[model samples]
Target: MEHKALWTLKFFNFDPSKTQNKRRRQMLELEEMWLHAYDSSRSYKEQLKSKWSGPFIVKSVRPHGAIELVDPAANDQQSSWVVNGQRLKHYLGGEVERLSTVMKLVDP
Candidate 1:
């Protein structure tokens, strides 16, 4: 079974590295991106926890796929950090003003 799995991958010329490089990403500034939250240690009781965080603002898209993210809720960003694009996925949830009480009157 292991040999068949290897053969299938080889036959399909599956290369995850190349696939990652070929992924089309046009992460514009101020767009929302969710950072993947990975937990190595987990308790069985914590099943309701989320695996992703954000709807974070895309502060900048750096060269070589590095992204700098900023929290939308936090006006002060002294603890902002950079992360690889692989650890993030674009947030698909649309902006719904009815659910939240924040308003942007002008561009800051």
Candidate 2:
């Protein structure tokens, strides 16, 4: 068994204060990107959708210096999961961080 990175991600909350209609459009873009990235990048052992849960859970891993996204749900849906370089290492955490396949992030 391996220790997993327990991330405190906030995708469902936070408001951008943009016009509601524009915000909705922006959110849709983020959502699409998140779904696409998860489908392509994460390992099959992980769940990439909003509705799934597991003991070996995977949460949304944000980019470095990415302040709590105004709307993580929207941002995650628009941007790609930054799965390169030290990014993966940061999320994996501790000893399990060495095992790249142990966990992953999905579009929340």
The number of the candidate with the highest TM-score is 1
Model 2: lowest-lDDT 10 consecutive positions: 50-59
Local accuracy of candidate 1 as per-residue lDDT tens digits, 7-80: 99897998887766556343432132332222323443264243235577678999999998787677687546
- Estimate TM-scores for all models: 0.38, 0.23
Runs off by more than 4 Å, candidate 2: 1-18, 42-108
* TM-score computed on alpha carbons, candidate 1: 0.38
lDDT of 2 by residue, 1-108 (tens): 123322323333534665687889999999999998887777553544432221122334456633221223453544433232342223343443333555677999
Query: What value does the lDDT take at residue 33 in candidate 1?
Result: 36
Which number leads on lDDT? 1
* CA deviation > 4 Å runs, candidate 1: 1-52, 96-108
Instruction: State, as a TM-score between 0 and 1, how close model 2 is to the true structure.
Output: 0.23
